[model samples]
Target: MTGPEHLSGTDRVAEVIKDIDADIIINIQGDEPMIDPAIVNQLIDTFEDGYVEMATVASTVIDNFDYVNPNSVKVMIDGNGFASAFRRETKDFEIGGYYRHVGMYGYRKEILLQFTKLDQTKNEATFNLEQLRAWTMEFQ
Candidate 1:
């Protein structure tokens, strides 16, 4: 029942839940049907911190193929285990490693609504990652 006007999965989810009463919302991308439930639980638990407005999962990357694959998004984690950046591919001279970004997203209801209302950011368009849009807005 999703409309064609929605540009991203988050937008469609926002529309569907607009009338529902909920504090937290979880978004799982179509390509990630097989993702582990434990990860989803972990995402939900992140809301225990009032400071965490949004959260996503990331797993360690062990294989070289996934690291080089453009379809498998990579996440650079800061010292606090929060993602610093997301990218499809690594730079030639990049020194450190990155984790495989899980496709699921957890958002507070208010943040989800606000996020869908904003237009896409340039970094999001260039990287093809909705998370980038959220990240850019977090700082701005």
Candidate 2:
């Protein structure tokens, strides 16, 4: 069983994994069972770099999305292939910079533990995106 105090799935994962021995914790949403195993394997491979403490999957969105809609969260990846932001709102609805943010996450064990204990950020509460807390806290 997990604690009721868990505000997010990641929090629950942290609770379940605290005493377990593992190098990586893949936090995939219960609803996302269809996530591609190949992509997950690739993401896990990125951890071999040692500097990557956390990572999330993202894919190019071919369909036009309503940027104002909270459901279509976009991942801002810089030219160098690093995520700079995750947001539901953007003024640049015309041009580009819209990569669909996949919910799957890979977190190092220690980082996951530290993440669960931190307080939520304003942007996180506003957008209901817990990853915002990680971004704002300088987790990079």
Candidate 3:
């Protein structure tokens, strides 16, 4: 894989994944120094199905107002467990109901490769979300 130019740590990570051979790659946020081994195991378990292109965990949101804050991005999953969309605010919200998107992500090798080649979209650039670039190409 070629070296990244002016890429953030997350983008550089996608570049490194291009040359790996593993079926699934788990990206753990380094900032969470106190993460439990059990949580790591659970993350790996979530991707047991070979077809899962990507997977991540989410904890129930205790605050409804936080769900509308742009700093606190929200994610919704499809029936198949794939991420359907991510945004700051979502409609049809009941009080005390939300799911905070965890920073961890598991991805298949091919999907990771494809992710590195996609162009950034308007929403992606505007929101400064690298994940949107991959999902724009249906890679996520």
Candidate 4:
């Protein structure tokens, strides 16, 4: 299915989910060994209202260097606490309220299936963030 092997994480996810059956799926990164159970519970609770399609956790950034570091993924949250944007670069106005995006994600089963089929957007490719592909498609 590929000459150059450009399957991104989302693409691989699409491939893996073909056989799974579930109502809700939570994706927690393998590297996050100390992920809080409370955060996972909070993300799961968001689905109980039945309005959220996709959700992720973001932590308050305590260090200035992490806020400006390209390795840290910063998220802009809306007035309602939903994510507005995800980026490696921080905006000028975000210095005070910036939240660093945690790698975990919760997705409705159908939405997760649909996400795998989406084409990678330019912003996603540039940032190397598969989540942006979902954001670009307005999945939430």
Candidates in order, TM-scores: namely 0.92, 0.90, 0.74, 0.88
**Which candidate gets the maximum TM-score versus the true structure?**
1
Runs in model 3 lying further than 4 Å from the true structure: 1-8, 18-21, 90-97
Whole-model Cα lDDT of every candidate shown, in order: 0.85, 0.83, 0.67, 0.79
lDDT of 1 by residue, 53-136 (tens): 889888885468877889989888888877788999887665356888888998898889999999999988887888887888
Ranking by lDDT: 1, 2, 4, 3
Going through the candidates in the order shown, the clash numbers are 0, 0, 0, 0
Question: For each candidate, C-alpha RMSD in Å?
Answer: 1.7, 1.7, 3.3, 2.6
Candidate 2 deviant stretches above 4 angstroms: 66-68, 93-95
Shift of residue 3 alpha carbon in model 2, Å: 1.5
Write the residue-wise lDDT of candidate 4 on 29-54 in tens digits.
76677898998999899899788998
1 or 3, greater by TM-score: 1
Task: Pick the winner on lDDT between candidates 1 and 3.
Answer: 1
Question: Which residue runs of candidate 4 sit more than 4 Å off their true CA positions?
Answer: 1-6
**Best by lDDT, which number?**
1
Q: Which stretches of candidate 1 lie over 4 Å from their true place?
A: none
- For model 3, how does the per-residue alpha-carbon lDDT over 18-87 read when each residue is reduced to its tens digit? 6666887888766556667787788888767666676666656436666767776677666876667777
User: What TM-score does candidate 4 reach?
Assistant: 0.88
**What local lDDT does model 4 show for residue 55?**
88
Model 1 TM-score on a 0 to 1 scale? 0.92
Clashes of 1: 0
Residue 41 accuracy (lDDT) in model 3: 89
